[model samples]
Target: MKRYKSILTVVAIAILGIAAGAGIKVYSILHTKSADILDAIESSIDSGSAQYAELKEQGRFNILIMGEDDVEGSRRSDTVLFATVDIDDKNMRILSLPRDTRVQIPGHGVQKLNHAFAYGGPDLLKATVEKYLGQPILYYVVIDYNSFPAVVDILGGVEINVEKRMRYVDRAGKLDINIQPGLQTMDGKTALHYVRFRKDALGDIGRVHRQQQFIKALLKKVYDPRILPKIPELTAQMMKLFKTDISPALAIQLAGFAQNELGRERIFFSTLHGQAATVNNLSYWIGDTKAANEFLNAPLEMLISGDVAENRNTNNFAGLSLSYSSAADENGNGKASGTEKKPGQVMKKDELLDLVRSMPESIAVLNGSGKAGLSGEIATRLQKIGIEVVMSANAKHFDYKSSNIVYPINAKPEVVETAKILGKLLDIPSSLIRSNNQAFYPSVIIGHDNQKLMSRIDKLIEISTQ
Candidate 1:
């Protein structure tokens, strides 16, 4: 239900529910007594130039809509969609970005896209999407679902065609979703159940499609002229759910659309095209950059600066990790409700070679066995398998019996995993993996066992590459 509430939050999200009447900012309906709620929405940040030349040049205003799954007090973004609000055409384009889409997060290794929200909140999420889509996102709305079901109830009941019967009970979420097949009128809870169900074959991909469908159904109810009399109630429901940086003028423009000739046809849907691959035995979707851009009709350069997101890569030896911080508002104002957790997950090399490539690691090889050129030879071998050789030199001593990988305490997730993989490849003892917090690189000191390690390294490189 937390995720469902989150979805309701994201449903305003992209839906055009009107703002409040009289003189008031759009998101000012909060009734919280807590100082924290007041702090979270008290953003005085100027979103953009009064108007953006990019919007005029590109013919669309990009808005990011994200919904968090507050399950177990974990705040990973459960739903992420880029809403391209085209002003000139008076249309909408929502591209549902998969939560698992492999993309680079600034200051972190390449991992799932949705982790951005969990780590840095909406600001980071906007930045990540802008980089991925190569566009400017001028506004966003994050809903807290405490009073969300009320919004659905106020709209009467949304008419939806059930694809099939759905029956699921989740104790953790305290959700009981059981509905028979065919056309139905779903109340707030039932509607939430319908949209949040994902036990079927297509999994998340299918759920994304269902979200788009639920949105259209919800919009149809919103467009009904009967809603005119209930404008006050509707406005309050919307205001309470949304948290955004949208300018008042843009909000008004969006509200004006309901009184215009806008229809469901104007809203198009898109999602990232990618394949599922295992990284460290964890499932992540390797996004198809070309396909994502093509679907959106906007190239990367058109949306992001320098036309790139640096942390993302399409190469072998690229390490991976999801950096989801504990529950907290991206803004410093909101505190996480849960206890502290570890920085990232431990990745294990999967048994299959079909696994996706990882982010790169800086590897420095040093000869310690009085071998004059062994370091350079080993460096060349490592490079063939995608581990970059940043430095190659002789060790201070020449009497070491075995080589080992050294990682720093402050090493990034990718570096740690890379060192472990390298250790395994070299048959380095677990005890030999030194935690050198001050080390600049993941250093490898070649010992007298170089010949034996090299023999294994050569075979490992051949297998890793092909």
Candidate 2:
């Protein structure tokens, strides 16, 4: 019995198809004598339906990709990914779902996410994912593992830096993986083995990471000039390997968009937020619904701009509310003397300095104002007040309206308190200080509204130093 798990290859095939179309377009443009190639490109483009145009006009859509495996006589999805493609913004965000994640499978009660495929194939899996994320899936692609290697071989292999030596043998499954570490180009079979080897401590999570890495590498290979001439061949091969609702014309249109507009910086990847738990003696990854939904509903700006930390922790602040009655409330306790301070009220300068000095964690400062060097400047001011600045960089895009202090959902009370105090010190509204499960650390996103606070922060720094 061979166990198949070539999940990322499904995505690679879709991307390859798009890349092929893009390459053909480029090739046709350069070689006018290739009348046959040019005609195919024209025909694909002309075949676009009104629905496809409407979807493009809608600006964004979700796609679900599943890698199916036949075990004994039942089919299960070994890997599931939900993708949100923002057309107008030229950004693509993908969230990988662990196969063992516990979910409500329609007509089957509660079961592993992968079990949905065994129950009803792609349609049920799509519905399960949509219900899980609270969003509609517009398209789906299902690819068998057997066809994955051929696509990689077609591309002449992909370059990947294997982190460690991998050796595994499963005679029962007819699987034998042996790969050396470091940078190497992998052909179809080697790449499949590379992604499927999951005997390490991280298990499936590690495999997911490897798959993501492979996807990126595959994308790079797809754009390689050497692959341009092989576009037609690759496209035909991919069409035969995958089952998808996307028509040839729509795929070509998207491929053109990806090649022409989507850059490496615009692509983002994340895993479904969850925790490993044992239920009824069965190990399962319990999905964090609130945190996952928040992540999915998060603005595209934030997703594209912020780094997706590998070790994500969930904090559910769903119904919690905070009210500050006085300066003492900044200490994480609501009890305080004197007149009640409103949510956005500024704390005394001395108090703000004390809070900054007492912060328990370092913070990453991001310039969401679109201004160069803004984060570094703020970081300097923060360091002057004894706050450790761990990272300083520009947010991917800079259209933020106001500054925000963000802490992880499961952040320590002191950390949350630090964010609130920092917010007051910087004159940011209390509402702007909130929880974000994706935050790697307590962070400050300096928006356009806070760009003018340089002088104010300078004065505070000077006074604190004195």
Candidate 3:
């Protein structure tokens, strides 16, 4: 699996080079001979004009970053990223589109997103993505995978914690990856392997998460004080690695704005949520277009405030039979006891049972309620209902207020639907059910609210089974 790194290096180098150039301007004024480099930098900086300001005032500008590879004599984009730069707000939102995402090409019928590049290179891919996203892309950066390693090497490697043992061998592609789990400094080759390892259950979604993590780590390295003095040389070397439509001046201005105004907290990263599917015997990722549009068009505050997650949950569960059954709600009441079911909101007992039976992914029940053996107990209860419980363990922390059913962003539609049914079965509120691309599988995080559910588990099982 081929993966691409984020465009943080491009922005980071621009910011560092501009900062260094600004500092050198004063010294250059005193020494005529030293002014040549400063003059060149100043000329580039002068490229910022009224149009750039107008775009900035409009709140955000979008950039498309693509990484391409040659396979079987055809060029295809392995990575597609949409970067929304909120200049006024001093933040950026990067959404990665999986290569296998099903999309329509201009002259071609519906095909994999990567095929747009193979069909007409970056131009077609850009137009296809813009059409798919319903947003205009103002600039584009295309990086060839061959140059990726050189860029990483220029940064002196990045430190990252390998979450698991990754081992893959592709003799045809001359690729061999064998990386163990632990915190280690990864050089160019190793970093490439780290981002490209997607053989695990999560597949491309897993790779996307690692790419985001790697970007964050790389950004930290770029901002290190020691790197300040080497900006000019690093920028010169790195600039040669990628092809972009962004002007040197505009790149500097944008990066400077980001570096000066944004903090680590302000930068947000997300993947275009979707599900894996097979159409006509060929595997493809079906993107959630509605959710993607809402996310792209949402207000900066909402995006930063974590409202996007809630919005996604709403969109994913819309019109789905993931609601409470006629028997109970979170308060544990039925219509007979004066707890009237909302019109068209009740899921039949049979439907819930069928959903559990058809669930494809095993869930990891985690105890976040600070209760001992709660995960095991819940796992057992889930298994009783025909749901598989693959792992039961303590959560990273134990202060959760309400139980949550967490599924990966790239989970199959059926998996998500089944997760919702599972959530309803456990009396978990829809608000707590979320999609996390970082997760390896659909999981149940048992919270303090689940204590009540524990007492009702037997009754719940009885109701579901009946």
**Reference-based lDDT, each prediction:** 0.58, 0.65, 0.64
Candidates' RMSD to native: 21.7, 15.4, 19.2
Stretch of 10 with least lDDT, candidate 3: 327-336
Candidates in order, TM-scores: namely 0.54, 0.61, 0.58
Q: Lowest summed lDDT over 10 consecutive residues: which window, candidate 2?
A: 319-328
Which tens-of-lDDT digit does each residue in 104-208 have in candidate 3? 889998999988988887788888998888776766788677766766777788888887899999998888999999998899999988888889877776776
Candidate 2, residue 292: the lDDT equals: 56
Q: Best by TM-score, which number?
A: 2
Candidate 1: regions farther than 4 A off = 1-53, 298-466
Q: Candidate 2's residue-wise lDDT over 1-466, tens digit each?
A: 1122222223543365445544454433322222232233335432364324534444466788887766666677787888776654445667778788898888898888888988787888988987777776767888777777888998899888888889999887788999999999999999999878778766776676677778778776776667867766676667656777665545554555565545554566655656678999988878776655555555544443232122235321121111111111222112112222244443466776677777777788988888888899899888887788899987645766556677775568878877876766776555456665446677888877664567667766776756
lDDT of 3 at 147: 68
Q: What TM-score, to 2 decimals, does candidate 2 have?
A: 0.61
Q: Give the TM-score of candidate 3.
A: 0.58
Candidate 2: Cα lDDT at 225: 63
Stronger candidate by lDDT (2 vs 3): 2
Total clashing pairs for each candidate:
10, 0, 0
